[model samples]
Target: MTLTFASPDQPAIALHVIDQDARDGWLEAQPPQVQAWVAANGFTGALGQVLLIPGADGAPDRALAGYGTTDRRARVRFPLAAAAEALPEGTYAIASGLPADRAEIEALGWLLTGYAFDRYATQSAAKARLVAPDGVNAARVEIMANAEALIRDLVNTPAADMGPDQLQAAAEALAGEFGAQFEVTRGDALLERNFPMIHAVGRAAEQAPRLIEMTWGTSGPKLTLVGKGVCFDTGGLDLKPAAAMGLMKKDMGGAANVLGLARMIMALDLPLQLRVLIPAVENAVAGNAFRPGDILTSRKGLTVEINNTDAEGRLVLADALALADEGAPDLVISMATLTGAARVAVGADLAPFYTDDDAAAQALSQAAFQAADPVWRMPFHTPYETLIEPGIADLDNAPAGGFAGSITAALFLRRFVENSRYMHFDIYSWQKAKEPGRSKGGLGQGPRALLTALPGMLDL
Candidate 1:
């Protein structure tokens, strides 16, 4: 399903806002046509409810979409989505009564209502065109929609068609499209490059695990993005049960989201030296699989004890983060489908990000609010550092206590990062169910927010 922006000569649809307290003169200021439409349809402004008034020829004339109150920002997005569902498959323009900046979000809403993941089945055609409002930034809206579509497509694809090698191809494709330099270090080369933790976690898979690196831009402050690219996590030696492993195909959602962000950055042509580091690996079970209670060396020269092989995202990320740290970029941010604890804490809609730098955290939070991407700030409590201490080694991959799992995971990744200002996002990449602009699949967590924030960060 696709949402087209149209400028047809077809009759326009007036969006009549319904108000419940009509007797108290709540809707006295409304136009006669709107008042008549409300009276004719018997519409009260209850949330999520909509009414269609018929024209003189007995065809649908205009729509009355109910809202809670005039002063509230309590508009229902799904009802707007239901407009896409209920309206006759054709183009429609909002005649009046919507805030100026909301057009972009409304366009996103229109596109989202038509999104369907039909990889294994046939898809039905979509028929809804939300006409762009005058003076609205249609190009920006289209860019965001395409970026989101890219992320959703990658995340929804099954592991059978998207593995480590395929992930590399995707990254390389992104680099090629943007005229960026791309490189990959695989198999024995990982060991040669001192990426021992990466080699240890991925040695069992038929596909040799590697790091995908791409660099774009030539000037301004350096920005590095690191994403954990575990394609299909079988939990390695400490394997997950069947139920727990069901959604493991989305393990590389971090990689998908970063690629989406890259698409936006290059599309907008942000002035910054952009670097992307993705440690692509498949944590599959095999004879040579790394097991629990094993000590592993890291590229950063930190000795790690594998308390559980399922915590392999951090391992692969450690090597990648070490490489990013080596460059000492001005800013480094890493995102991952790293832990279930994050979902337990913030649910799927709002991803939680951890950062030691207050200014960067504020900037990210501000960006999230401005873009409507919405990420919560998780504390980077330095006291939690003790939770990741290893008795036998320099650090333990999995902490003993289940409490503060997400915080501990952030602490674990922080061990490999130094010199650069860093932030970590422990994201539950998949959305459980569909919402206004979010389709029910692997969701793009931070790209939208970061894309909005990067241009100014690079002084573009």
Candidate 2:
């Protein structure tokens, strides 16, 4: 559902943020009746708890939202978001208790909670809205929130509704909105473009395999982003278990995230030329499905032995990353739902990132902390590099030991990138449970951290 923001980003109501320890000082200064009512209600100012106070006339006067307790700390991931969701459906103005610099992320979090994948359902109620706070880039916050919502919507959609063609169309629509140049190489055209691995994996699906590309900005440092866009991974010829297949629609989360990041860059007009590449495909089973024993030559001409068909995300990404590396962009980062090993290590909330550049890695680490997007660095250890090099091919798509799956996958993609500073993010884009700001499905990992790191990375 589309959200509404107050024109001029003005406050329609007051939203007070407080912790139990500090609630007394603020409550003591309040009028006697409001204090009496709050005490009577037994509100302790727990995190995510919101209480609405009444005015003298019994009308809703203001909202009191709890920040976490001082002792335990908090995720603070959109700390103000719960307040926005619990407050009445209208614009809200947050009261002090947080830093002014955090206004954008906090406000953006509020905007995100209002998101619902309403494609199949009718509206039940109006969503609570927030007024842009002072010093907050209200327009930019809205743009980023909308872009995030777009990612969730795309990822949450089922394979029937969100195939390779639909993903290409979505990218085309985004390019049209930002005046970026859009192009796609579909079906056998992938072969013409020397993307044989991508073509091999996706050839069995009904929708033709394709690479979606968009370019924007002409000057400044080149920022090229690549994402794995497996629209639905049925594990190809190897197939997947029923439970594994259930969430397969979200396999293209990396694609949705990069597109969301592209949206943010274009909307904020970051001073860097940007190019986004998504190898959109559906790994379906058919007589022509690429076999597990099959050896395929990648765009970079490196032969990969298909140790398992389930490990197909890296195949398409290898071709796209090869193409991206050719541009010699200042930085080339790729994100993909590439391995279960990553999820097993970090769970769904934290995404694991791999980078050979120490300067970039340090910047991203600091940015991740500042932005509250969790990213842990996995080593691109040259020692384990041989794990991907099975005797039959230059690399093994699924190494036999089953050890260091994520690390090995990152090492595999590392070969495709020749010149640019490279970073690879293995993300579990699906949120199995609802959090304060994040909903229950389809999330963007690394993009926010990347956004936070870009200014320093690009020397902007």
lDDT of 2 by residue, 223-334 (tens): 9999889999999888898998999999999999999999989989999999999999999999999998999999999999998999999999999999999989999989
Q: List CA RMSD, all candidates.
A: 2.9, 1.7
Give the poorly placed runs of model 1, Cα more than 4 Å off.
1-4, 7-42, 51-61, 67-79, 124-126, 456-458
User: RMSD in Å for candidate 2, one decimal?
Assistant: 1.7
lDDT of all predictions: 0.79, 0.87
TM-score of each: 0.91, 0.96
TM-score of 1: 0.91
Off by over 4 Å in 2: 8-11, 71-73, 123-126
- List model 1 lDDT by residue over 1-460, tens digit each: 3344666465566554334343226356656765687677666655445666677787667665554454443434333554454455656667655556665665666666666778789754336567777666766767677777777888888988888888999889889988999999999899998888888888899899899999999998899999989999999989899999899999999989889888888877887899999998999899999989999988888889999999999999998999999999988999999999998998877879998877777777888877778799998778988888877898988998798999999999988888998888888778786565556787888888888776555456
Query: The CA-based lDDT of model 2 is what?
Result: 0.87
